[model samples]
Target: MEQDLPPVLSLDIGGTKLAAGVVTGDGRIHGWQVTPTRREEGPRQVLARLFDLGRKAVADAGEPEVAAVGISCGGPLDTATGVLGCPPHLPGWIDVPVGALAAEAFGVPSALENDATAAALGEFRYGAGRGTRTMLYLTVSTGVGGGSVIGGRLHRGAAGNGGELGHVMVRPGGRRCTCGRHGCLEAYASGTAIAERAREALATGRPSSLAAVGNPTAEDVSRAVESGDGLAREIWDETTWALGTAITDLVNVFEPELVVLGGGVTRSGALLLDPVAVAVARDAMPPAARTARIVLAELGAGVCVVGAGAVAHDLLSGKTPGKTPHA
Candidate 1:
């Protein structure tokens, strides 16, 4: 019956990119399109382009009649009202009524969701978390973020941002986080943090391959670690340590069946996963540790697109966007 459901138009708005696609109930994406966000254009122009991109996707997919529109974006948003608060990634775009605009453009209902929270549902319903009843998804990209699926239901906490998992403090008074906190997991484990740490070490005249890079990035640090660069290895170790420590805390608190790591930083693969898995296994309470499995996300770059589509599907089916039937 799900396969007979109409395709949903999915749009993902990120600071750097905008992606659009048509997704069917089987969780496959069609007519995927991506373009640079050029966010400086601000919301009006950017949203118009995003809507056109969605139209293009529908035409390309040969499905002109989508049932609903689903949007995913970085948040501090009010999902119930579909209003985007001033997200740090999109400066000056405050209190935009994105859901109403999308529904007007497409002549259908729409649902807006926090990008990370959407990705959690995406993975849970279609990817790595397909069979799991309880899961946690952490995106360690430009910044760290996360969401949870607990007891077969997506958990959007009271504030509706699905819990700020990245803000959990790891060190009492270490590096400053974007949230203005000290020693948060984001300050230590995000891709931006990894790259910044490498650059700072190079500034001290440390010898390493990363110094040769004009502007080192997290990927550069990962590559340098693979090549046996001492300074890069140190930074990598600290990144993994911060992630493992924070995840250990989450495991103890939630006891999720799986912890799925997504986003650009997770491309490091075993280099990132192995250390974190080892730490959790070695340090977490035995019962929780034994129950949790750590793995990389399967959806990769298209995660938010697919996740938003899932939300639309739920909307059309008269189900709460993030809740499973069992819940």
Candidate 2:
């Protein structure tokens, strides 16, 4: 029966990029494709392109039929209604019925999930949290997003986005977050925040290797820090410090067995993971800290696609809503 179901089609909508893939039972992606999102184009135009991309992925994968479609995007969205609800990343998108459209386009039922929530399911099913009973997944990218699996169940909060982990106030009266909040962890630790801090520092006419970067990105800052650039190092320290502080708080509250960090920011590897791990270990409640391991996500860039596919797979398998099947 499992083999009789067609491979699932998965789509991920991000502020900066759109991705699509066909996922098999073993959690591998076939015919993966990614393109710039160009959010200024508005939802209709973007969805058209996204659907075309999905079609291309399906054709390329040579999977003649898709049993279901799964879509992953940043929230505030309603998974129950499959509507996009003014996600800050997508600017003008508001209450767009993304899942219904996907279902119509592919002639299959569709499931929608918060991108981070989908990623959590993805990592839990096939990545770093495979054998763990409880895990937290945090994505520090264009923004900071998180999802949790508690008691071996994916926890989609009442609002369906689980929690806005980035919105945790790490500094009072600090930088403003996209969610219109001040002093949130996203204000300091996200990739956008890192780049913004570097640009702000450079604007003050300080001397550093980053000065040569023109408009330095977060990656540039990490590379500069690796090369011993003092200004970059300072910005990096603050980023890691914010991550550590927020993660420490989360570890205390959730007592997860593992915290898996993913997203573009984690590409810095040890530059980001080491300091955050140290901070969580030294700062969280001893019992929580002793039981939790902080680690990099094994799924890397394809996590969301696989996650969305996993969601679709559950649908085909007749799994009940809000239930997570064990790995």
lDDT of 2: 0.90
| Every candidate's CA RMSD | 3.4, 3.7
Off by over 4 Å in 2: 1-6, 318-327
Total colliding residue pairs, candidate 1: 0
Give candidate 1 regions above 4 Å deviation: 321-327
Q: What overall lDDT goes with each candidate model?
A: 0.92, 0.90
Clashes of each: 0, 0
Can you write out model 2's per-residue Cα lDDT over 1-327, one digit (the tens) per residue?
434446999999998999999998778899999999999999999999999999999999999988889899988888877888998889989899898888888888888889998999889988999889899999988888989998977788886788877888999889988778898999999888999999999999999999987989999999999999999999999999999999999999999999999999999999999999999999999999999999999999999999888878877666514222122
Alpha-carbon error at 152 in model 1, in Å? 1.0
Q: What is the Cα-based TM-score of model 2?
A: 0.93
